[model samples]
Target: MIVGVTGGIGSGKSTVVNFFLELGNIAFYHADIEAKNIINSSVKVKTKIEAFFGKEAYKDNVLNKKYISNIVFHNPESLKQLNAIVHPEVKKHFKNFVNQHKNKEYILYENAILFETKSHHTCDFIISVYCDLKTRISRIKNRDNISENAILDRINNQWKEDKKLLQSNYLITNFAQIETKNQVNHIHNILTKKRKLI
Candidate 1:
């Protein structure tokens, strides 16, 4: 089975997924982190991004994240074009990763935009994490050290919570660490039992 965990910015999907990571027999794929790595390490990807976004896209072999984020967050077309360059490579990487770990109980695919990228279709189950708006905003502000407008821009780029919940097989309301970990343990037990019957 392939299980996915996703949520909007600051929704604590990472914190929840970390608990799942502690469980046995489940491989993990962190899409955004891999995508960033691919963009940084692959010469083909570097050339493509530089060609479209210009040399400013990178500085001394590292992605100029602020430069790219500023452009893509404000311009939908730029974001689409950027995804077009990076996603295919990440998909290929993920395919290899899944094959390597196919014998495991399941793969945990963690992504912030799993549904937006239509990657949820590849999952056997999905957990959507959510928190109150104020909590999310505060978390992002503290973690990312960005202004509210920039944080909201990232949030707005994602699908609404209502739509995500509609698509999810599980929902995790991540308000506190202990509560979140308990939910993860509950889900992990359920998934463990689920695999046995398969």
Candidate 2:
């Protein structure tokens, strides 16, 4: 089964994904990493990005993330155009990943914008990680070393918790390590019990 685990920016989704990694029962595919790889490796995508955002999209053969981010965050149309280019490439990459791991008992696709991008529809089930906005902002600041305003901009672009909650099969609220682990275990138990995999 393909289980999509998603959450907004700074929502502790990675922490939960790590817990599942420790269980050694599933393979995890992080979409952002794949998207970066696609952008850097695919000449077609690179050309398209440069055409849309200008040569400033890349510097020294590396993605100039800040330059592109500033444009997208400040304009909805730019963000939509960028997503249009990136999302298709990422989807094709994910399809290849799933094909390669067809024998795994379960696979986990972890992404920050799964719901917003409609990527969750490809999965058999989904888990939504959540936390309060204040906590999320604090986590982002500590993890990414970015200003609060930058974090807020990313958060504002994500699907709201209420919207994601409606589509997810499971919800995990992360506040602390202990609570996060407990939630992971709860979901693990449900998956095993329901599938009779235990």
Candidate 3:
């Protein structure tokens, strides 16, 4: 089984994925990290990004994230172009990952843009992690040292939480006030049982 886990910025999706990892049977593929790696390592991706964004897109063969982020967040067309270049490669990488983990009962494909990139179609189940907007803003502010407006811009760029919830097979609320571990364990047990019947 392939479970696609997603959440908006600062929704604690990584923490939830960690809890799922603690259960000891699931293989995990983090798409965001893989996307970064692909952009840095894949010649096709590098050429396309540079062609679109110019040489400033990278610094000494490494991605200039600040440069890229500035362009994408403020310009929807640029963001769409960037996604167009990167997502297909990320999807290919994910398929290779899933194939390698086929022996596992299930695997977790954690992505921030699962729905936007249409990767959810590859999932047997989708788990969305949600949290209040205020909490999300505060967490990102502290973690990314980003301004409130910038964080809000990034958040606004993604699908809204309520809309994402409608598409989810399961929802994990990751508010600080709630015990997320129990929720993860509950879902983990359910997934394990479901995998057996497959």
Candidate 4:
């Protein structure tokens, strides 16, 4: 089974993915991390990004993430262009990852923009991690060291959590660690049983 996990910025999606990891049977593919790797290592991606954003898109062959982020967050078109260039390659990489882990009962594909990119269509099930707006803003403020307004801008760029919630097969409330774990355990048990029937 392929499970897609997603949530907005600072919603503790990583924590939930980690809990899934701790269950010991799941293979995990973090799309954000893999996207960064593809952006840096794939010559085709690097060339396209350079063409779109100019030479400064990279510094000594490494991605100028801050420079890119500033441009994309403020300009929706530029962000869309960037995603257009990167997401397809990320999807290809994800396919290969799934092939490698085909023996696992299930694998987790975690992406912050799973729904926005329509990547969840590739999954057998989807999970959304949700937390209140106040908590999300505070968490991002502490974690990313960015201004609240800037964080809000990033958050606003993604689909609202309520919309994602309606589409998800499972929802995990992340405000409390204990509750989160319990929910993960319940989902894991359910998926394991489903996998057996498959």
Candidate 5:
């Protein structure tokens, strides 16, 4: 089964994902990272991005992420256009990952925009991680040298936390490590048992 896990920027979703990784049986596909890999490695993707966004999209055959982020976060249409170019390739990459991990009882599909991209439809279960706006902002501040406005711009681009929670089958409210791991453990137990019955 493919289980999708998503949350907005700096919501500790990746931290929660790491807790899940501690469990022995699960396989993980990190969609965002894979997308970056695809962009760097695929000449076709690089060409298309450069064609649309101009040559500033890459430097020395590497993605200039700041240039792309500056373009996409503020302009929704540009973000959509970029997703159009990358997401199809990501889907193909994920299909191959699924095939490789076919024997695993569960594979975690980690995407920041799983629902936005409509990739959640492919998941058997969905998990959304939630953190308060203040906490999320603080977390992002530590991780990236970004202004709150810039962080909010990224957050605004995603579906709201409440909206995502309402749609999710599972939720991990991340505030503290001990409490967070408890939630993860609970879900891991449920999915593990779920796989057995299947």
Candidate 6:
């Protein structure tokens, strides 16, 4: 079975992914890693990005992420165009990954934008991690060392908790590790016993 964990920036999705990894029952796919690899590896995507933003999009085989982020975050249209180019490539790569793991009981598609690109449709269940707005901004500032405006901009781009909660089967408010562990364990029981995964 495939389960998805997604949330807005600084919502503690990564911590939840880590907790699942510690359980040894799931393989986690970090979409950011896959997206970056695709951008760097796919000739078609590379050409498109370079065409959209010029050679400045990359430097010496490395993505100029900050440069790209600054451009997209400031302009909604640019961000949409960028997502249109990258999301399909990332989804295709994810499909290939799913094909190889048919026998696995559970796998995770951890993405911050699961709903944005409709990737959650591919999963059997989804968990939306959440925290209040103040908490989220504080966490992002501390963890990523990003400015408040940048963090707020990213949060604005993500789906609101109200909408995500409606779509998600599970919701976790990760204020602490123990709380996260408990939520994951609950989901584990449901997946293993109730869902009858082998």
TM-score of each: 0.96, 0.95, 0.97, 0.97, 0.97, 0.94
Name the runs in model 6 displaced over 4 angstroms.
none
Clashes of 1: 0
Model 5 — TM-score against the truth? Answer: 0.97
Clashes of 4: 0
- Report, for every candidate in turn, its global Cα lDDT versus the true structure: 0.92, 0.87, 0.92, 0.93, 0.92, 0.87
Question: Across residues 43-73, which tens digit of lDDT does each residue of candidate 5 receive?
Answer: 8899999999999899899999999999999
Measured with C-alpha atoms, the lDDT of residue 44 in candidate 1 is 98
Score residue 189 of candidate 2 by CA lDDT: 74
Rate residue 174 of model 6 by lDDT: 91
Worst ten-residue run, lDDT, model 1? 17-26
Question: In model 6, where is the ten-residue run with the lowest total lDDT?
Answer: 189-198
lDDT of 3 by residue, 1-198 (tens): 999999999999999998889886789999999999999999999999999999999999999999999999999899999999999999888888888998887999999989998889999999999988989998998999989999988998899888899999999999753489999889999989999899
Tens digit per residue, CA lDDT, model 1, 88-141: 898889989998997998899998999888889888899999998999999999
RMSD of each: 1.1, 1.7, 1.1, 0.9, 1.0, 1.5
| Model 6 per-residue lDDT at 88 | 94
Candidate 6 clashes between residue pairs 3 or more apart in a chain or in different chains: none
Off by over 4 Å in 1: none
TM-score of 2: 0.95
Q: List the residue pairs that clash in candidate 1.
A: none
Residue 117 in model 6: lDDT: 85
Comparing 2 and 5 on lDDT, the stronger one? 5
Clashes of 6: 0
